[model samples]
Target chain A: MSASYSTHSQEKTQSSVFRTSVCKEALVMDDELVLRQAFASDPRKGCELLFRRYYTNLCNHAIRFVYSKEVAEDIVAELFANFWYSRVFDDISTSYRAYLYRAVRNRAYNYLAWQFKRTDSMDAIEDMPVDPTLKPDEVLQYSELHQKIEHAIQQLPAQCQRAFLLKRIEGKKYTEIAEEMQIGTKAVEALVSRALTRLRAELKNDWFLGLSGLVILSIL
Target chain B: MTPLPKDILFDFFDGKATPLQRKLIEDWLMIPANEELYYQYLDEWETRHMQFFPPLDEALTQYRQELNGERTRRVRALYDPPESPFRFQRWFWWSIAASIILLATGGGLIYQDQWRYSTYRTGFSETATHRLPDGSTVTLNANSVLQVPRFGFGEGRRLVRLTGEAVFKVAHLPDHQRFVVDMGRGVQIEVLGTEFVAYARNRGQHVFLHKGSIKLDLPQGKQLYMKPGNLFTVDADGHGKLTETAPAQSYLAWQDHWFYFDNTSLSEVVQQIDEVFGVQVVISESGLARRRIAGNFKATKADQLLQSLSELLNVKITRTNDHIELRTLTL
Candidate 1:
């Protein structure tokens, strides 16, 4: 098991990290240099640095899925401990941070999916994350934008619009869209392009980017 | 001659094309239906939720502490063997070794973790490719950030929170993956397996399906399955109206860095340039803003875009610092 951090820090490690600026920087860096040095070399400094590196980002990321600080913090601890004890990160080839992030995302999603089924009920937009920091105006804006977007989608041309939605919204491939639509790839591109053109015209090609940047955020 | 690979769709978007390669895509764009790709991307970019989401500061802080402590403990154990005396000198050596590691790893700063934070007051631009536990791939446009938890995904269903617009290309899983993209306005898109482009922004949002299928659960609780070539429209109330025959290519053109203003007015063009370049572009004479324009320009900096407009409109575009001033240039 390349998973290290094997030390027994599993004890309620408590959230007393100094919240040093260094950890913040490390958190910001891709998990490349850190993970590569996991076993091949010493990264930043030691296990503490690893904690400092990923602690907050992991916690924030995990909270979106888990809804419990205790669980979130524990996940961070385990991830760091594994990186240190086994240097499993050393085995990773892609962005170390990406790997860890992917891991966390998967864990969180699994928990959410399980929780969803246990409730025996599914609500569209269920448990909408109402961040306290989000002002009422922003919340309103998100809803307004959602409605506007729906109308915009309705305006797209028939074949082109269908192809665009199938590819972009459903997460399918062109071949899939083509096969489903029983048309060529060229047809799919047309659907997406035409749909977007109508939307651009509707918005008058105005401040959509600004609106989206603010409202569209990490749901993880 | 070898045919261009499938990447032309993306290569054109990123500006990595060679001259010959560019010529092909450009020529392809001229085709009536082909132009749809650009229009679609433009609409997609316009409405994506690319703006900032509230920073989760406090939660991030606590997680850091926990991870940091675990790391520190491991290092302590590695340096101070069980038999080694708990002497001051041994402890001091461990501290020094630890400090050395700290310096080598960049103090963990995520240098350029992403492109510049947000595009200037105009807006920041970013494109992200996400690999879901379900093995599917999703891409987010600039200014749009989709959040996913650290935990892994499970069977059948996959869920995600999307505050912004994104293009999804789902990789098929052994089990049919149930994919959901949640855009906050009570807009939830649920699909089994397919590909599509979703553009969501303030004032309006739209979706163009290129392949497979999708089920949209509107804010008002209406369930709509948008079939191939079937366009779906919904208002804030989730009341959906459908249409057929939408040319979908335009839905993705923005990815090409190509902005097409077909018979677009001057005011609208300038407004668009301002947002894209993150700089203020003011038409010196207010009347000129209403003038109509017909042509295509690079989806690039404000200056380049303005230059193209000036040339075609037979006008002069002057720049003072980042402020763009446009006026009719006597032919």
Candidate 2:
């Protein structure tokens, strides 16, 4: 374990570590160092650092499932509250960021299940397993793209947003959604269509780092 | 390579394509280049609709307020030593003696009658019972405390706040009056009429229903129902588990000045000792914390429990002025 840890530390250049910290230029260090400092002294600062970094991203991820801002905020806030009060923050096994994201996602699903009154069995949200082969920079870029995509969706017309969320998140069929929303089937289709067109136009010109033409072409 | 039409691909992505057009797009996506284009559009499709944007600043402020409230409540709970004047020592005799003297001097009576709400406390190696106005009864374990409101006894909700371990025998009321035990940390156990043991004091609470049933309202708006012989454990970390087990009557053995450890870890035993006897027991070796011991023993005194544990684990128990240290017996 010590050998692997040493190699891991060696892999992170001092410059990158310094670049990561915007405040505290002289004593800028890695997450592990920050964690150790937290374990030793006043842990609130370290906890706040982690909370600030991932709070927005986690809220965005959670809103995808629960679809309510207040509920999502309550979920994340309660998670951090428990994390602090229960001392799990001191004993995180995996990378702290991954742990926080997974926690938020699981709770969001649970909240959605409770809200939908499905107490017996929770329907699984089919999400693609994160591609482990992607580099750290690629992961960051993908996360940024994900947030940007969510923001763009939020900017769409209200009807388009509702249609897209019900179909995509709730996994509702267009016919079923049309019936529920009291609209015709073609309106649902056009709403989804308009939503897609707007999204495509919004992302078409935005330059994403390391997103080659071939990659975009292959995926489209 | 032939370029696939964008309109057909979009329909296929949304699962709205006709059978014939679906086949066409499927075939086109079979090509790696077309597949890549499919994912790009798929990403865009998934990204385009956002339902809500939480105000991060407001959420942060709320979180900070919750944290500060918790800290303040904890401090208030610990320091509000009502009848016990010399509570700083927290040692077995000095604190209990202080309480006894206060009780004799009518300090305990004054404290109880002063506030509309009543608080019940037990010193180390002591257990006390308080009967509520609704005919329900609560028995607190050693070093535990419970507060019952004087104003709203049997009116609507029979609510009691607990800071340590307690066993409750709730009276069944007509009209289905709610009997709720607020266990703090956003956890509440509501029972109409039941016999259950609630253990708080640690970061979380463990509730075992010996008879009847109870409903637990968790922090994240999830409700859990527990039946007889069910053990529900929830921690401050937002983790919860429900297990069906044998009647946990042994869990309340502490009420009788005894402890029953069934394959429990030494660390937990140490914590129980600290709670029940007001003595901090520190094991020098970290590995010894995991040593499991099962036994039924008396817990009237701190040294007696430590002595039994020393013989059981073959460790040397040393008691200082404030803390007890357990060390491996040196050969």
Model 1 segments beyond 4 Å from truth? A1-220, B1-128, B154-156, B230-243, B284-287
Instruction: Estimate the TM-score for candidate 2.
Output: 0.41
Query: Local distance difference test, per candidate?
Result: 0.49, 0.62
Q: Candidate 1, which CAPRI tier?
A: incorrect
lDDT of 2 at B132: 68
User: Tens digits of per-residue lDDT for model 2 on A10-72?
Assistant: 343332322333233222234455553544355566567667766776666666644445456
lDDT for each residue of candidate 1 in B12-91, tens digit (9 for 90 to 100): 43334466766675555443223323323322332342222223455345334435542232221111111100112222
Q: TM-score for all predictions?
A: 0.39, 0.41
| Candidate closest to the true structure, highest lDDT | 2
Local accuracy of candidate 2 as per-residue lDDT tens digits, B175-257: 57778898988889999999999988776789999999899988878899998989988776757888888547577777788
Candidate DockQ values, in order, are 0.03, 0.07
| Superposed model 2: Cα runs more than 4 Å off | A1-220, B1-116
